[model samples]
Target: MKKLEDSAKRGRPDIVHFALMEALSTPLFLGNKMRVYVHTINDRIIAISDNLRIPKSYFRFEGLMMNLFRDRSVKSDEGTVLMELADGTFTDLLGSIGAGKVIGLSTAGVRSTAEKVAGISRDVENCAFVVGGFPRGHFAQSTTRLLGPVYSISNVGLEAHVVIARLVYECEKLLQEGVDHEGDKERGKIGA
Candidate 1:
């Protein structure tokens, strides 16, 4: 929370708060265990990992997030506050996650077709999909360089929340269909 607030304060604006709430509330992300990383305006990254239950009510959420940002420690009625990574940049976060593929969501990137994007799930175990938190513009140069592929889910620019919801839903569906399992089986047969 502190990390989010600090990032929002530095220059990102309130868009970060809304994006965080939307992503946390989505069924794809809520039902599955996933980690969310917030890259603040000041180049600091805040990671929310493990069991994360964001508030449903906007007012309660705003208050809780604000409090967390200010105090750096606060109990939430909605969910447990897990670990936080401080003083880190987007690049640092990616590096710590190892050499996994990093996909950045961007307007100028390749269009996502059903056929081409379906393979996304196969890389889920070792990929990070990043959505910009700011209202406008592109990701920083440092962050862009770290990305393996940049994709635009919509022809027109969509809000951060919409992009995240759609991406997560598609990825989760592919995961449910056992894309990884099928690939592994094929690999074993080939090896044998």
Candidate 2:
């Protein structure tokens, strides 16, 4: 909450907007399998998935988000709107999503080897890979408790956009190879 308040005070809500855009624009999301839940600073959870479109311009995105935050709803010609806003904490939102595992990305967490990280998308039928929306600082204690395993993609701290892009890219690659939780070896084998 302090991180979010700091960003807002600094007039840098664009950071959060771009983080969301990075997640939604990924091939994994484009394939219509992943969902995004944003726990805002004001204690509201904004759930967006499927049929979502983000503005290409940062300022435009900022404007849209500002309006949505004010109005709590905004419709688009593309039929994309703020899906739903629920009153809750981050844990409540996670519980509602019911992902099998919630992996949090943070520099403070253990460094994950490539093989271990590569299996993330296939390890569970439903998973939520959470990245902090605020510019800096760690997740709240309650939220951290809900995370299954916190992993760091890089030795040094990474920007949210970079982390999200790399993680989603890896997940998409594995998913494209037909790797799924059911362990269908035949599906991942090319020309089988």
Candidate 3:
């Protein structure tokens, strides 16, 4: 993988790892309020189920991904697919999820706040957000074409993990549940 340091071809699996750590453990994701998917540099999509816990270590995540690629999917002990892989473009992913609107977060896109974007999400059913997994540059032309509205959450370029953290926080705030399983006030996904 060191050889890919000089190449963009699968060069930043760690970026995806870190972003998953920020997202998968959040209340919004853990409470079945949201779903996550990774669109790789090679055009493969990995759909992550909310119940699956991501490894905090990069090496473990690397090993898990190796198995996932080899098997093309990961299943829980009870037989629920934890993570599933498929060959698809970004457009295909949005369509498969029945996304009403595909919003992209890119440094190259129009400027906006995370809350504003989350606010917009409440208006659209099954809204999806696209955050790049690479360390640098913008979304490819093909990916950008499928996005309904691209937004920049910062005045300066931000790392993918940062954008993911901020967006998740705002979404938790904007979409918090009125009552939880225990009938307590808990921040959660929109309409949960």
Candidate 4:
């Protein structure tokens, strides 16, 4: 593993990484983990990762945030709105297997999808520990270093199998493409 620089400024940065409640049985934190994916007024997604050691207030906040999304309490232009989804909810639907704590905010005024992805990338730049690119329910249990948004996962229960299968196929295809490209380049080269 490469050394990741610390993004936390002084007071342990609001975002943290810790094991999820669901990972107790499994070797990894999966689905059972929960976190707050706060989207600030600036259009940033911030994942707050608090564990058993963290204050209960953090969990309260997590619960409240999840409720907001569940009840559709999202108010437009609320100037720093925070959104959340329980890890269990994700697992119930998308089968989220991990989580992390960090916020991905957009400086743009809710304009384009490109802007959103850019904001996510910017968050990754500020924090290098980000892996996979999406807020993962399982990864949240690992470290306090802010991570990236996890890749998209299907929410439908049985549909997850399709997503998983597609991901595997893509990974295999990419690996094959990489190997073929390398071989094509090397095959033409004459070594002394």
Candidate 5:
């Protein structure tokens, strides 16, 4: 058997599973402002439903992924596509979304705080953040070609789950702030 470290093994689907869970649990997601797209090592993309209940158990999540690959999608009880395989390279997904700004998170990127990086969501149309799904190594050239801004949020390398959680938290906070700001504005108009 070829013994590769767990992270180095077969693109590490578990890492992607955990990262998706992190992002899915955020307020940014609950508020319906976030969408998830996964680009596979084999040049396919997976689009996750905003309301899909991601399995917490690694074994279950692995099974779900296998089923998705086999059937090309999973549907809700109502037959809505909860997850599906989509055509395209990572670049094609970007073009289809028309993301005004695309930022990639990497330890190799320019040092920046989560606050500044998360600000990409403000005053932007379809802002997208690229968090690596794989545990080790950097994004492939196909992905990097469309990754516009690259930011580093840590002094040391961190796991994909940690990065996804922290970034989603920051983005969620910004979304809340916008809501608060709008409410305050409406109150001022009423008082005027």
Candidate 6:
């Protein structure tokens, strides 16, 4: 994990676009690198994660409508926010960001195409996917419109990279521990 952080820092990560015009037909997006984009309709927030490793159980797109109504409640319309999960789960909260009292909703799920699936490759290590270029106030609509076409680009390339990075870090740690355990076992055998 430490080495990965160093590697990522040493090699500046690149930003890739997940355009809907091309994304709708494909299952993946930009090579193994991670990418984040806002929906055209409600660009209130941005979604990012290891698009592929994300189990369907953790994020679902099919039942989002019903779950939105059930699990979340408006704590304060003035500064209320709701967070939704892929598996029909959500939370409510409050906050203000100077633009006015606003609510935030969060969720994870699959990208809607196969091109996006291909986008989930094993290229980069760890990178941040940022959403930019939109004027203020029109973010939500832009995101909604983007999401409107494709069902969901569930584990896109950017997310795939994130998953790979995490897995590589964990695997490296486990390998080191395995080596230590083997040394201990050998030492015990010699003592016996």
How high is the lDDT of residue 155 in model 1?
83
Q: Report the C-alpha lDDT of model 6 over 75-125, residue by residue, as the tens digit.
A: 224444333222210111111111121212112333343333223322323
Off by over 4 Å in 4: 1-147, 153-158, 189-192
Ranking by TM-score: 5, 3, 2, 1, 4, 6
Predicted candidate 1, C-alpha RMSD: 5.6
Candidate 1 lDDT tens digits, 71-176 = 6645436756653536777777787766367887889889885335536646566677788877656877777888888888778999888777777767677766
Lowest summed lDDT window (length 10), candidate 4: 20-29
* Winner on lDDT (3 vs 4): 3
lDDT of each: 0.68, 0.75, 0.84, 0.32, 0.84, 0.30
lDDT tens readout by residue for model 3, 57-173: 888899889989999999878999899999998778888999999999988788999989877887789999999887766777888888999999889988888898899888888
TM-score of each: 0.75, 0.81, 0.86, 0.24, 0.90, 0.19
Ranking by lDDT: 3, 5, 2, 1, 4, 6
Off by over 4 Å in 3: 1-6, 177-192
Clashes of each: 0, 0, 0, 34, 0, 49
Evaluate model 4: give its TM-score: 0.24
Per-residue accuracy of model 2 over 17-106 as CA lDDT, tens digit each: 788789888877888877877786667888785767778798788787777777777676765664566689877887788878888888
Residue 137 lDDT in model 4? 28
Q: Give the alpha carbon lDDT tens digit for every residue of 1-192 in model 5.
A: 137533442567878888888888777787788898888766789988887879899999998888898999998789988899977888788887899999999998999998889987787899999988775678877677788989999999999889888888888888778788888888895342
Which has the higher TM-score value, candidate number 2 or candidate number 6? 2
Which candidate achieves the best TM-score against the true structure?
Answer: 5
Return the TM-score for candidate 5, rounded to 2 decimals: 0.90
- Superior by TM-score: candidate 1 or candidate 6: 1
